[model samples]
Target: MEKPLLVTDFLDRARRYYGDREAIVATTGDRYTYDEFGARADGFAAALADRGIEKGDRVAVLDPNTHYHLEAAYGIMQLGAVHTPLNYRLVPDDFEYILEDAGVDAIYADYEHAEKIEAVRDEVPTETFVTNDTDAVDGDWESFDELVDTDETFERPKMDENDVITINYTSGTTGDPKGVCRTHRTETLHAYIVSLHQEIRDDDVYLWTLPMFHVNGWGHIFAVTGMGATHVCTRGVDAGGIFEAIRTEDVTYLCGAPTVLNMLVDYYERHDVATTGDRDVRIATAGSAPPEAVIRAVEDDFGWYLKHVYGATETGPLITTSDARRFFEDGSDARFAVKKRQGLGYLGTEVRVVDEDGTDVPEDDATLGEVVVRGNQVMDRYWNKPEATEEAFTDRIEGYYHTGDLATVDENGMIAIRDRKKDIIISGGENISSIELEDTLYEHDAVADVAVIPAPSSEWGETPKAFVVPTSGDPDEPGTDVDELVSFTRAHLATYKAVSKVEFVESLPTTATGKVQKYELRQREWDEEDRMIGEG
Candidate 1:
């Protein structure tokens, strides 16, 4: 049977087929079934309609991973309004820019983040402010819990498959954030593609560790619910809490960034953990390509299968998968090496590595070029910005969306990421991938987090310097020292990728979505230069 291509159809099917099944367990000890979830969503939809929320209007949500956030997503989508998920960690100015840019009609913000929106709400086009936290009500703002208590039910609005459903703002390293507008068709197809690669099943219990505001949590909301799987809402990404949730809730699947994986490995090592539950859990990691050591630990130490994926917010977030390959008949070690490359494109996606003129790069496993993609899952356009949207799809060889990421295609057609066009560090007429040095430095025992950028060198034109966060603050800790870290890297990776200088910090700068702001780190080194090192 064919269902509507919209997300509301997915939610309705889950409620009809799995109404008795648990859909969410909040950190505050609240639980909801598919029926209850749908009812809450419907109630909020009615409430929004009362406040003049019409189809095609923009409703922005700023909150952490919670049941409230999920309900807001369904409610907005049900009304045929485009849901713009905001990163709550953004500063007041960033929030101001996005709300004004999208021309949002209403904003649903968590209690902790309400003030940031309130500070500039008057300047934005928004007419309503719905507070998610019970304690965050002002004279003009409405309470989220009050909306849930309403008994009104609104009919789901009629929607075309290609209608815009969501707009996600990406944190590009060197420019202002661009809103990636995705249609119902694009989002649904991406869920199917990601589910195939992730092996999502009906019995899977998924823990929402990844931020739901990030590419709609990589489109898992539709994928998991469509499979009749259970979701456990997590308030924070604490390792202890995640471990307990997996053990108690029988969680089977989850996804996060490489930084999240790093946190898990660090916690597991320091605490000497055994098992989260009797069964092994599967985790999908992206945001940054993980090192081989992190992959090994997830398999050997944690007994979890870590799947690596690569994508940006513009690609509906599912471009490729790095799973087991057929040509690795040699052994597991060699096989793991191949799996590290971002694998072939998903079902409806076409990926190519192309040179400067958009010519295909040879698959000799050495020739590096920018990755260009074209797919049904690609974003429709940047919201309200035709120039940026045109630029994003420009210079297309047969209508491909040019990804700014640089990579190398292997003989087996697996894509190994080399660097971003903006992130390459050139030193003494030699080009280096900052990712290479950061990956090498991640192996250091003391480095909890690391970002490599080009530093001004008196001899070499530019050299790699690492800004690192030690696992333990004390440098005198048994295994924590800068010299030891440098020595470890020198032994592991090539000499060029070794960290030239290390600065111990409490933490590296990060965006609202948790990606390390390496451009900011690079700016500290390149302010006086006549030219930036990498773009040439």
Candidate 2:
């Protein structure tokens, strides 16, 4: 008996097995059981069908983490339409490019962000505009609640596992964001992997700290729902709001980037709040290897376990997790050490750090190579970009997807990312990891946030430079001495790896997901130079 694998099965399972369970706690103070939530999804699906949204139609969803976003995702997929999630942080121009690029036919936007879509609605090919809050919206938009108020049932369309389920756009550091196409099989398999690795249980209560637009909340929407766990939705990530949700909902698990974790830690310290609660909360962090200092604070100060995972938009957005329970149980400093690395390849993923020739690098923990992966969870292709798709998979090893990240494999097969290929600083033939330098600087009490980039230097070709956001001082004026910060890094890292100069900035430019945009900084430094690659 062979049945097709589909992401919709997650919702179906919850509807059947956990109908009476509290399925969602929305920020609007609304609570719904699994039965009610499933019905809403069905109603939304029927409404889309009534509106002539057929199978394979590209439907974009633009919102922060909210109940409407979650229901819209399932409803869109139920109607066999492609779920295209838009980054809420992007501008109207960015939305215009994505809507045009994805050939989106319809959009379901949040009231907070409907104006961005409305501004470009005339330029794109989209014909239908739906919003969760029609009263707040000022354009020709359908009310999401009105549509879902019906008791109509939706017919399940025949779907194959290979059918494209969603189109996730990348952050587009250098150019317009690329649409990463994912299939039902890839998304479902990644959800199972996430469930197993994150230890998601039926009783688990998941807090929506990560944006649902990012890789479908890193596939937690399916993973948590499929496990019959409860979802606590927040409009956005705020320190006080997150703590209140965790305390009120008895949240068991959540995911976020390092920046979010840092914000939570700072809030906890300043307000003298406690992370302890009735249930133990586990957090999964990615978007960069969290500094060891941040990991320690998360575990020790916050009283929560931090699991550092790694992946990209093209790779199901989840490939590795640093559970490292065996090492952490030893009760030594090695516990934090293991949690800091990217850890081993995920259960069904095959990750390898390889050189230019596609040969695996030595597991000596020093050799840097591009990270390539071959797995069912990898995305199928880039939507409407054959040349880019070919370049992503064809140039690398026969069947593996090349991740632009550079990393080193240790003897234990643990993968530690050194830097992105472009972010690596080469000073006098020495390779320096900007991440390592930033991690060391994060340990400083005065440092609030930091980004390390290569600065053009006459003596060493290019040297590491730190962009510092001080905790309690004016960035424009003298607060934290640059010499003191440089000395701090030199004491922890090699002399050459230490930042040669420091630039005090109000804040680092980041993507919507809180990932620092190093390319912008690199462009400023190399605008007058002939090449971006540091002289060796």
Candidate 3:
């Protein structure tokens, strides 16, 4: 009755009960059962132990969605070493910062990305540089295949549930990247909640469309594995490969950001492809709130169920889901509005939309406030940054994690994110939600993707500018023009909310996790301005 909740328990349970079941389908097309996966994890642990790695030592893993990523993760955790995963898309400078900040003793990088680490080998504190393919890489890297063939057994150090087991670095959009420290209990509970909401079944087939480095694939590494599901791995995300995998592997469940949804929709529209096989596919989209038009295309056009969740990296990466079945009784049309909202918080999590004074906002669906949450799944603190940790939890209110995301809660207690606190555009003495403007533009057929940001205006102090990625895939040959899009937005929304300027672009700048980088857009608009913040 008093069993400890350890992240290692997930793999242990799977190996014990679902040992014979397929655990992972490697990017190389090889399959491994849970027994084999567990054995490999043991081998990795032994290899780390042979290199004098002990409990609490930071071990960084930089790779894509591959079998070795999972093996290295659980293997590092088995020895109670802190599992520090790096964003594979990060450059050598970022890698150096994280490796130095975390004081990583060793790093296991994929052959594709190991060169980034080797580029700054002398600057980082990381000593043991191992890669999947030593021959493929330029540096003197050890072969991962040979390392995992260790014959020695590792002694697992005793770990407490509250011990810091993982440290995930933030995207550093605001400032220097701070390491978010999490305990075993936090990850274990977050995995359980994700399993409950995502409705992962043992027979379900999961596709690795999401980056495994992204919050440990948004904690699916444990939730999916613990459920005894089949993992179809991929080196990178491709719409064509995703479709082929679904039709061939019978993928029933997957997760991605709104950008991924847009890519799939664009791909599906240009080509005639079967969306799913015999399995009823469920896709969980987060990183950012999806537009209603995109959500409709995903459900009506692609015939796939979309669950919209919301949270940041420090907040378990998943604290809310929009998969409430009761709201979809009227059919797919009703589900669009419901799924468009971020919906309710997961069980045991307290989510609230609070005003600047730390008071809760009324659920009239009109008032805007910052979202705050408190749960076991939330991160404990920033690694070695106590001041940053204090500011995060005690910003607006004490003890509650301040999300910094502006939102509005409905009558049913479902929260819909309006815009980020810094991204909200104030023009001509009126507050404008950038997300609302983006959603209005997305309804136009010519608009493939769009991002709205505030530009400095002498007339109104600040006015909204639209960056549109058209369907033609050519910025010069965009299917739509400025006057047309402006009039289109004016007809759909209020005059003040309409975009003042429009620019057509081939693509939008996005983070490694696929979230659109709105700050980058803002930086360009305010490059000649005196200050970063715009005046109302």
Candidate 4:
């Protein structure tokens, strides 16, 4: 007999083989077995069916990292429903647009994010709302624990590799968020890529630092779960909390952005954390390329292995990795330097660097070009947006997913990102669009022209900072309120995307063609760093 090639099928096999093994370790010291996790998933599936959720339906989950959230994801996917996770930090307006745009049938929220969803409940098409926390929520909603008490066993829905398993919404670096539709084939293939580079093992204890909503937590939910590794869940990205989890849970592996890694390094240096159960821990970071200094600190100071990777929401989110070489032990700085560049494509992934003319650039590490990829793990399409999806796949490239990232490829085939072709601000791994922020800022009566860019932030890695050339009021007006402009924009846009700092400039530097030179603005802020994109 052959096995079904599906994400849910892998979960069932893990349960059958590693039934007694610990599946999840919560921050509050709660643990669940594979059997318990599987049963909870079954119960949740039955409850969703009871609520009239059918196959191919969309169920949005807005929560922090938790055991129940993981079960909710699996439970929804097992029944052939699309599991969509939302960023809890997004403001109500953002949530309102996404919930309605995605046509979510139901939402399973954490206690912290329940209020935001409640405020806009009537606008969205969501038919049901459930919470992991029971107290003080709406009367209509049901408790997560209560739903999991059902005795009904869920029969796995018959699904093919091409069936859409999840619809991950991008971080909205442009206008309205576009959903990246990924099938079971892509998810399963991405998991294999992660397992190969991340070196997944049955004994590895994985910690959840990255948000589950971010590329299916970098596709580790499938890879780690399939390998039967223990998942240690943390409520927030607290450096102390992470170290404590690593120590107590004996966590061997974790994934995060550069901001998360910097926070841990800073915390370790301040608190002087020596060891985790007499052994060092390992971490994987993505988003912006990490600085060589931070990479060295993770290896030398914190005694943790750090791997740099690059990907986007449309690219199955794991295209390349800068895995450390074993020869770095020979005290060669060159080996460490090579490991800093995002390494070549993972197995089954094809990557290329090409100029605007569609010509492949020489791998001299100086010829900059757009990075594109085609792989088994790449997304199938942008949901309901055929034109946008076609545009993304078209251009000079033939049968490739355009990444819209400007980068340089070295002779060794390692890729170093240079700039973004799109005006996207990546602060702490959250992708924010300059166009979106500028549009909101334009609503201000006092505003004239606005240009936004990624400004360096120690805490957030990069925050949105605005440069404004005021309207015809005054050249040097003392009464110009910057906070007032910021507040006005915050009212329209999400809180995370709001401008943290604003400067009144006489005029922005532009090219001869009359376009704002964002590169010049970014260069001024990031001049001191080795790379324009700060690793933090």
Candidate 5:
């Protein structure tokens, strides 16, 4: 009994078993059951086939977290077409570059994001422009509603499990974003891992706080749908809107980056809002660990359990979860400490902290090494980039993907990230973790959001500089002085790891997924330097 593992299998199951179940709650105030949703996806697939879209055509989807995006994803994949989701936060030039790079043959964009694609429509190879906007329709663009208004059916192509199903682009921190190619088998296995780690149940209600474009919403679209969970879609991530959705939709589970959690915490404290309601919500956050203080606040003050997971786009976007429920039963400080570390690898995932020579690092919890992983869910390659693909899997140990993140493993097998290999600062021949310094600063009352980067220095080769967003103060004059903050870091961390300088800013630059772009900060600091030097 061997069967091809396809993402459309989840949709098929939902349509068969939970036909009348409420499947989607759109931000546009529309609701659809699984039956209706399946029909819409089918109609979209049929429309594409009618328009001469071949099975292998590359279809791009540009939208926020909307129902249309979900339908478009299923429809594109239904015809065995490659789905390419564009980051909506990117500029028009970035869009043009990606469309050209991916060789997008067709596009389905929302009204809000259509302008970015329309600006470069004539230059790219795309022949079809499908806009989901009902009110505004140009002569060159086709209306999404009209396209999916058909009752005709399309035949499903014979799909291979190893066929590339989606191509997700990286945030392009250093240069142009690289397309991470994922196959049906890879995503299907990743969704199974997500279900196992998150403990997804059929009664669960998932809120779309994370963008659908990011790693296929961290594979929740398939996992939750397969479990027959109701989806509550939000157009964008807003603190107040998230709270409203949880209260109104009875949301049981959600995922977001640490920045989103920080926003929610700030909104709750400022508005005097209560976190407890009729439902008990569990949140999964990644893209940099949440500050220990924030984690404590989320559990103690907000009455929500925060699970810190870790991974990147190239690694199926999920590798480990910090569910310490088995080891720490009581709600003690030790429990929170355990929950803060990214726990063991998910079931069937093999994770190791390896040195440059591919030797496993000691579990002393202090020896830093790059995190490497091998699993069924790991991506097969980078789209159209053979060199990048070769480099990703060219680890000393064959069949493992290098994650480019520096982390340490404790005796208990709990993994904690120290810093990105590039972001680690080497001052006086000592490695300083920017993440560690930033985490220490987060404990200070005056500091709100912070990013630590290596600043060029003739005295020590390089030094750690903190760019801080104060909770309340003038950007020019932060409430906490630089000397005091430096002293505070010295008090908590090693003296060598103390911040050498501080800059007060209104905000730190971030990717679309809310990850602080440390490379941008490093570029600014080392603009005049000949060689970028660091050790981690």
Candidate 6:
């Protein structure tokens, strides 16, 4: 007999089996057991119910990677309301759009970001606003501390596995942010696969370096807690702070973007710091593939295992991983190549690299195609956009979520994302991968961060342009000149793929999740050319 897979089951099981175990190590140095955490969640659920929040209402959470996020999320989910978590880095305009679009009924923003919501209170439909520190926020908001201390208990509603329990908004890189609707089954299965691949165990200590708002911290909120692991909370991540947490809290595993790994490596190089604690540490990086050099330094120099995974918010945000030990030879240079690719699909996930005509690309590792995926973890649809939903699933395939990521499939069927479909620079009828160019440039010591975008070219239609953030952190005096860097890329890669133009910047603009905002750079480069190209 099979039981219904509800997201609430995770916390229930943890409370039932590991009730007395330490559940969370808060950023404020406060600790909580599973029993206490569960009680707080129940209290928040009661508070929402007291405020007349129904099962189908939408509740938004705006906070960092803190325990409050977990409590508010589970609290909202227990009532079967849609748990809508906002990106903390989003401004008031972005918040207003999402809040109104989702028809959010109530919101819980951290004291640090509550002002953004207050700035747009009249613009959105949301009514109830709560913050952890009401006195600190100059608004008509209630204290979350008081709200979660409700004496009345709430009765959880009967929820189906297929109900849209979460509505995750996209980053709106290309257009308006669309809400990705996901069901309980989708989230639960995603959590299960995350647990299996990340190798989470009860004795493990998970450091919250990743933002909890991002796909629910890539679904670790359920996966890690369900496994009865200790959660070491972090307010924000820095190289020094991350290392200190690892040593002080005995962190064994964590997840972050490639930028976070680079930060840790750079800090480790500049300062002598311990890398691990009492237990061997493992780090999983995604949002983009980490350079093999960073991966090697992480594994060899820092003495930590590195796993490269890939996915998007529309999907489970973790459909593939490069943790296949069979291909990995510990302490061998050959294994870095395998670890660099976004490895095979997770169990029950079908990831395919397909051509424009919807046929699978040859597994020769040279052909580029769009990556599409179909799995139980994939989102059901956009919140209210049927046309957009239809186009997303039926774009190049009938039943798969179009990832819009161009990738190549190797002989072993492991996929490596080359570039985004729009980011692929078409110069003189030749497709130049911006990722390849950026990767080549990353090998240079003068480059601290880099973004490669397609710029209008007089002869080639479009040429690859490089925006380099120097190691010296000054744009005016980039240590290395354009000619030297151009020669460096020419020596490492094909001449056509080399950057035709270079611009030095203080830093590259990135998303809250630490992904370079190449769209911004592309817009700035193409802004004036649009009129000229159109006239031509």
Give the TM-scores of the predictions, in the order they appear.
0.79, 0.81, 0.81, 0.95, 0.81, 0.81
**Candidate 6 local lDDT, 8-120, one digit each (tens):** 99999899999999999998889999998999999889998888888889999999988899999999999999999998866687798999999999999999999989999
Top model number, TM-score: 4
Residue 351 of model 4, lDDT score: 91
Tens digits of lDDT, candidate 3, 111-199: 99898899989999888888899889996888888888867798888899999999988766445668999899999999999999999
Cα lDDT tens digits, model 5, 129-214, are: 99987456444788887888898889999999999999999765434578999999999999998998898998898999888988
> Between which residue pairs do clashes occur in model 3?
none
Residue-by-residue lDDT tens digits, candidate 2, 38-94: 888888899988888888999999988889988999999998899999988666877
Global Cα lDDT for candidate 1: 0.79
Clashes of each: 0, 0, 0, 0, 0, 0
User: Of the candidates numbered 4 and 5, which has the greater TM-score value?
Assistant: 4
lDDT of each: 0.79, 0.84, 0.85, 0.84, 0.83, 0.86
TM-score of candidate 1 versus the correct structure, residues matched by position: 0.79
TM-score, cand. 5 vs. native: 0.81
Tens digit of per-residue lDDT, candidate 1, span 80-108: 99999998756676788898888899989
- Give the C-alpha lDDT of model 2: 0.84
Residue-level lDDT of model 4, residues 1-536, one tens digit each, is 95546888667877999999998887667799899998998999999988888888999998788887899999999889999989887888888888888899998998878998999998899988999877867646789889999877766667988888899988788778899999988999899889989898888999899998887898988998998888988888898988877887788888888888778878988896754655558788886776677777777776687777889989989999877474355235665676667777888899999998888899999988999999999999998999889989887687889988888988778888877788888888888999988888777766788789988887777888888878854537723677987787777776777889888887889999999998899999888776666565
